[model samples]
Every structure is written in C-alpha cells, then in structure tokens.
Target: MPIVHHRKPSLLSFPMWLGTRVLLRPTLSLWPLNKAGMAGLFLIDRAFAAGPKPSGVVRERMTLDGRPVELIMPSGPSRRDSETAILYLHGGAFVVCGLGSHRSMASRLSKETGLPVFSLEYRQLPQFGVGTSVADAVGAYRELVGERGYRRVIVAGDSAGGFLAGKVVEAAAQEGLPRPVAFVGISPMLDLDVGTNPDRSSRSDAYIPQNKVRELTPLLDRGPVPLQGTRRIRELADDAFPPTVVITAEGELLEPDAIALVETLDDADVDAVAHSYSWQVHAFPVLTARHPETLHAIEVTAAFIAQAIREAKDADDRKDQRAG
Candidate 1:
C-alpha cells in the first residue's frame, strides 16, 4: 500500500514508543517487516519518481471508480499482447498502506506475468471504511473489462488486500459482471469474529496480536463510511465464491482463513488451490529478492499465476474451436 517516509527517529514519545517496541520486537521478527511492526507500517513508502524509462514500457495516470489510479503497460516488440491484466488490491488492515508501498510487488508481478498491472489506491479506514474500498476495487475491474476491452483479468491481494479481493469478486459475481478467471489471496483475513477461529487466536501468531480483531471492529464499524452491517454477510457468503487460490504461511495466525477459503472454493465447484509455505511468515513474498524465502515465494507466485493464465487461455481456445 501507500508508504510514507520520515527521517526523524522520534516520531512520538521515546519512552512509550520504546516500551511498545520492546514488547513487540520479538514478535516483529516473525513478520517480514522488523522496524515498523504494524504501527510504523506506512512510514516506509516514498513516492515513486519516474527515472530512466524502459524502452517499451508505458506508464500513465488514469481514474477508476472516481478515484485516481495507475496503469503500468509493458513495452517491447517481443512482449505478447496481453489478453489478461491484473487489478491488484493492497492490504494494510483497511487503514494503513497503499499503492506506494505495494508498487515494488506490483512491478515484480507485472514482469513475471508479462501483463500490465493496475494497482488501485482505494479509500481506507477512519475515512472511507471497508465498503468503500471494496466498491472501488470492484469498480476498477468492471471499468477495466467493460470500457477498456480486457476480456480476462485476475483479482489478487495479500493479507488485508486478500480479504478485499474476495469481497470484490463476490460483488462481481452477484452483479453478473464477468467473474475474474481466478482469485489469489495471500494470508487473508476473513471472519470478523476474533474468536471464531482458534488458529488465528494462537499465541504463536507472534506478529499480529490476538486482539487485532477487537481493535479492527470499531474501526470497521463506527469509522467514516463504515461497513454498515454487511461485514458478516460478506464473511459468510464468500466461501462459495469463485475459481481461487489462497496462499499463507502455515505458521501465520491467519491459516484458518486459508483452510476455510479452500473449503469454500470446493463448495462452489471452483477450480482452486491453496499453498502454505511451511515455515514462512506473513507477506514473505514481498521482501528483497536476495532472501531465499523471498525468491522462492516469488517463483511460486509466478508459477501459479502463469498456470492460471495458461488454463484460462486454453478454455478460451476450446471455446473458439467449437465456435469455429
């Protein structure tokens, strides 16, 4: 998501901050980000400045769902004209994070999939709330397909972004817009009841506190542009969703969401897959590529997306052959 950067060391009180850090540091190592924990999560993002441009790639500004958005187009004669694109949602607990912090991840996926990626900067909590974010996310997809002539696109996100991906796809299915070819969720947060899933409540979850659900509830409820009682409905019905993939670390607190998602996909008869990295932490896929875990996660992500792309192409080809 959006990243805000600052050079100042003491953004707030040193004693209280140090106390918080001391308490949270052990848990921080369990997550991909060590310095920020969750509090400073939005600090790392600095705006992306246009630099020496790539020869064939095109970058432009556009508006989606009334919100300003970005589209990254690949250039090169050898690059295949993409029949598919990705509309990405970034996760920051519906509060922090945005397109800036997520740009690197988006760019890597674009390169790997050889397809343009659209990363939406949707409304966030304490301002726009969950419903607005989901609306904008779904809106981006519909606009892309209906107005922009993209036939097939995938909806993907990580952590909280993954939750939004599921919500948007569900909305699309209900609205009868052509459903995305596949859905990929990384360490998703589903089922608002903090106690509903024990896997998510375990002490070993390390990074995310056990009370995160309680903390997030008021934010999603009374916050600006709140969910307005639809949160439970979304959580319950999202199981019978669509062709999907749910990826998470087995060690993560959210593993149950992944399992529950698999069960939901099965109920819907959607072609689906769930892959859990054995010893991985949350959002391990977005780290520097030099780390072995990061490299492996990226490779796995690329392979999964490529497979989905190929399968989607095959289905279209078969349909064309029959029509011909």
Candidate 2:
C-alpha cells in the first residue's frame, strides 16, 4: 500500500487536542454521534489511510509467497541475546488497513521493548479474503521463527487485526508449534457472530458502523476462498492459545468479544488480561504517544511482554540446571 503524507499546518496539533477532549468527557461515553463525531473519525481514517510513516527502520518487500510485508525494527541495539520479537497485525475491519497504517505504533512498541517487529500487510476481505491473509500470516510466522531463528515470538494487533492475532496463535498451537510467548490484542474483534454482544448497538452512537460488522459476518463465515486453503487457519479452543493481553474501549461494540476472549482464556488456563479504557475510541491505544489512554495501554502491554520474556528465560535456565 502507498503511504500518504499530509502537510496541513494544523495536522499535527488538531487530532491530539480532539482526542484529549474525547478522552476526558465521560458524557461522551457512547454519546450519540453527531456529524462532528463522524467527521473526526473520517479525518482520522483518512490520515491512517494516507499511510503516515512511523518512526523506525521499516523493511518493506514482497514475501516468498508474493504477498507484500514490512519488517519494522527498533532503531537501537538491545543488551540481551536477541530472542524476543513481535508479529504485528493491522486492523481495517479486515478490509482497508495495512502495514503503513500501523507503522508508527509498531515502531514505538519496538522502542519500548527493545525487540524487532514484523508488521504483516496481509490480504483482506472483498479483494482477496480472510483465508489468504491468514495463510500469509502463518507462513510468515514459520519463516521468522523456524528459519530465521527468532525465539519467543509474540503476535500483536489492533481491532480486526487483533482477531487475526488470536487466530494466528490458535493456528500455531494446533500445529504443535512453539506458540508465541504472548499475544496482545487492542480492541480485538473476536466473535463473528452478530448481535452476540449488546454493547454493539451503541457503536453507531460512537461513530462506528456496528451494522457493518453484522453485514460482514456472512462473507467472513463463507471462507472467502476455497475451504481447503482457508481451513489452514484453525479456530482453537482456549487451551490452544498463548498468554494474551486485550485492551479496549469500555463502551465499544467489540467489548463482548474481548470479554469472551478473557473468559475462554481463563477457562483454558491461559494468562489473559483485558484492560478497559474509559470513554475512548476503538483501538484508541494505537495513538498512544499523543493520547494518555493509549500511552498507558502501551506501557501495560510492554510490561506484560517483558515479563513473559523474563519468565521464559528463567524456565529455560531452570531446565538447563536440572539437565546439568
């Protein structure tokens, strides 16, 4: 996807101020969105759509499968034996968003954790479909972990990308692969079932088209391509997932999915935490550097990932000691 830059004199300060306003007013809590709310969402969507460059070392290219992918590395060296990495997934309702939309956020994540990131520009619905995109993600994971020798990989994403992140971890577990050490989903869309979550109805009031989610269900369930290829991405039970972190707006439509994920993960004995930010937009944490909620969310997420890495190292050392 092409990265679009905006030179408007006010582009930098405008959204920051507006985002603050939205964050502060609890009354804005799923308040009926007027034209202004829609406009703000539209403008922000445009900025993301225009593909703003994120601060980091971005390596973009076509993968062995001919799909375009981007690898984002933090701009510094780490002090430890490099073993941790994140496979980032971008959200656009499984239709619009791409690697570029999430570049800046991923760069910030890499900087905080001192780990490299591979932001997948997977295929989407309508044009290519979910099956193709899922396959591409699994392929990328195998390549990065199996061939490239990256250990302790994490799968991360926002919104629909979060859904894919969960799916990727599930697929990995099913294959009996070393599952990602962690999974972080920001405002994830987990369940494809419509009207399953009551909070969904309020989304239209918050400038999100909740009906669109229902509309997309059939197409999503249809296995966008042939079943043989699509079936590669498995739907795992709770046990077939890794430790997960979910961040979401308190009143957003997908809150139900997030809740269900936590319940399922808990039942399966997976470590999972879902942080709720009050009066925020969907996947609001991605705007972290400017937004406090986002910044806090990232801090929490980074801490989780770092702790997981430490625990894994400790366990390995214990195993070595026992063997020795």
Candidate 3:
C-alpha cells in the first residue's frame, strides 16, 4: 500500500473537529438506524441541499433507465475529455444527500477534470439496501459506457458512495462490462466488517461507531455478493480493477478501512495510492468549500483520473496500430 502522509492541522480543521467530534459523533452514534430516522435525515439534508448551489456549471436533471441523475458540465465553452466521462456517486451513508446535495462536488469535478459528471441519485436504505443501490449504480454506469458511448468511464464517490463505487467496479466485471479506467474513493468504507475488530486505528472517531457498524452491516446489504463464495467487499477487487486513489482522514473510523483496501488492491497487483491528512473529518473532500485540504484532494483525484485515462487511451491506440 502506498500511503502519503500530509501534516499541519490547518485552522480550517477546527470547525470540522468541533462538528465531527462535538456534534456529529454523538448524534450519529445515538440516532435510530431505522426508516424514520433515515427520513428525518433526508428531510434535513433536502433542505440544506435546496439552498444555494455552485456557480459556473450547468446542471441538468434527467433519468437514465428510470434512475434520476444530474449531468454537470462547465458553464462556458469547454472541451470534453473526448469520449470519457465520470459517473459520480454521492456520499450520504446510502440514505441522505441527493443530486442537489452533492451538486457542488460534482460540478467541481466537472470543472477540474474537463469531463461531464453524471451524479446518480441511487436508492438507499430503509427501503433499498446496499445491494439495490449497487444495482442502480451499475445500471447507470452501463447506460453511460454502453449505449451512452463513453469510451472510458471513471466511477468516483465519497463515504458510502465510495463503497458503492467499489461495488460498481466489482459488479461491472462480473457482468462483463468494460472495466472503468479508474476508481476514486474518499473515506470509503470498503468492508462492512470494518466495524468489528479492536485493531482498527481510530474506531472511536467521528460519525461511525465501531460497534454500531458491525451490528448494522448485515442490514446495510444482505443481498448476495456478486462473486461466488465471497461475502465481503474487499475480496472483490482483482487485476480487472483500474488504478485507484483513496483519500482518508487519519484517526477517523474509515482510515484503517482505507489502508486495508489499498493493501488489498496492491496485493491484487492493482495500482493504488492513499492520501491521508492527520486533522480532518471523514469524507471531508466532499465539502467543496474554501477548505485547502479538500481542494488538494480533488486536485489529486482529477490528476489521477486524467493520467489513468491517458494510459488507457494509449494502450488502446497501441493495440489498434498492431491490429491494423
């Protein structure tokens, strides 16, 4: 696993520190993990998302195979990445946060990568578990890369969406779909079993309870795994997966999970890198505000995706030349 450590606890972290540990931690740890609870959060998130959105991006609401999605692109005359696009899945623990909620990050990604970003509003828990959400995501990805005619697609997400991103990479291969050129996960929870195990570096950190995750893992996704005899997500990655970049907040609940996932990808001979900041909250990259570290993470993610696509394109060109 290639781990890059970043130091300096910026003053920006103080608010996140207070928000995560002081506010979010207790609330998340005690909240009822039921439909009503999810609904309440959804309402709250909906209001927040309904507020001011990002500027300089054209956001269009549309549906792909009956799934609601938002297509975000740069406002002015811009050049596309040329047959390459991003299928972005937003993080919200598979419950709250929708297109409006995640529009900022998606729009920023569009601006940064010079590619259209399709932010899918997948089904979530209380009605649909992780399996159903994964199904929706995979279907959207297929539509984009198959009929939609994107030659190279990258699946990227944050938090729970990151988990879905991983699942999309795994399921795409099982369905014989073209492999994504790259995968980007920020504070992704790759393994539901992450909550178990006392060895987790920072199990006590914000927004995720070590014990709660273990108990809630089965409820999150009880459907059959795409791979036979393999129940955990970490077992899904193989050589078929493209290069991956994961950003984790050190001392947060998902840091160890990110480390373990990078290790898994590395062991599978997949190029993987993890960037960690010591003083940040889980999934902070999605903030998309004036945060320095968040901006840095997004920059790194875009660079990785661009480089991966270039390599993939080069390989394709080489093969075509040989065939001709």
Top model number, lDDT: 3
In terms of TM-score, the best-performing candidate is 3
Q: Cα deviation of 215 in candidate 2 (Å)? A: 1.5
What's the alpha carbon RMSD for model 2? 8.6
Q: What is the lDDT of residue 95 in candidate 2?
A: 64
lDDT of 2: 0.66
Q: Candidate 3 lDDT, tens digit per residue, 1-324?
A: 388898886888877766878887777778887768777777765775778978888888898768999998888987776689899988877777878777888888888888989999998766777777888888899898888888899999888888778878877787898889999998887765666666774554756666667656767764442323233556776677789999988888878777777787888888889999877888887764669998898899889888999899999899899999
Please provide TM-scores, in order, for all candidate models, with all chains considered together: 0.77, 0.77, 0.92
1-324, model 2: which lDDT tens digit per residue? Answer: 011111222334346435544563343335333334323443444577476566655455546245566666666554644777888888866666566567778878877777878888776655555666677777778777787787779999887787677667766766777888888888877765533445456432233455555555555543454323222121453565677778877666776667666767777777777787655667776654566666667888899898878877797789889999
Model 3: lowest-lDDT 10 consecutive positions: 222-231
Q: After superposition, how far is residue 72 of candidate 2 from its true place, in Å?
A: 1.4
Compared with the true structure, model 3 gives a TM-score of 0.92
Better of 1 and 3 by TM-score: 3
Q: Please give the distance, in angstroms, between residue 89's alpha carbon in candidate 3 and its true position after superposition.
A: 1.2
lDDT of 1 by residue, 1-324 (tens): 011111232222234334433565355435432223444555544433332233445666788878767677665554654578888888767767776676667776776677888988888755556777777887898898888888888888887788777777767767888778777776777655543445455454535665655555555543344453334323533444556666666556777666766766566565666666554456656533344544555666667778877877898899999999
Off by over 4 Å in 3: 201-204, 222-231
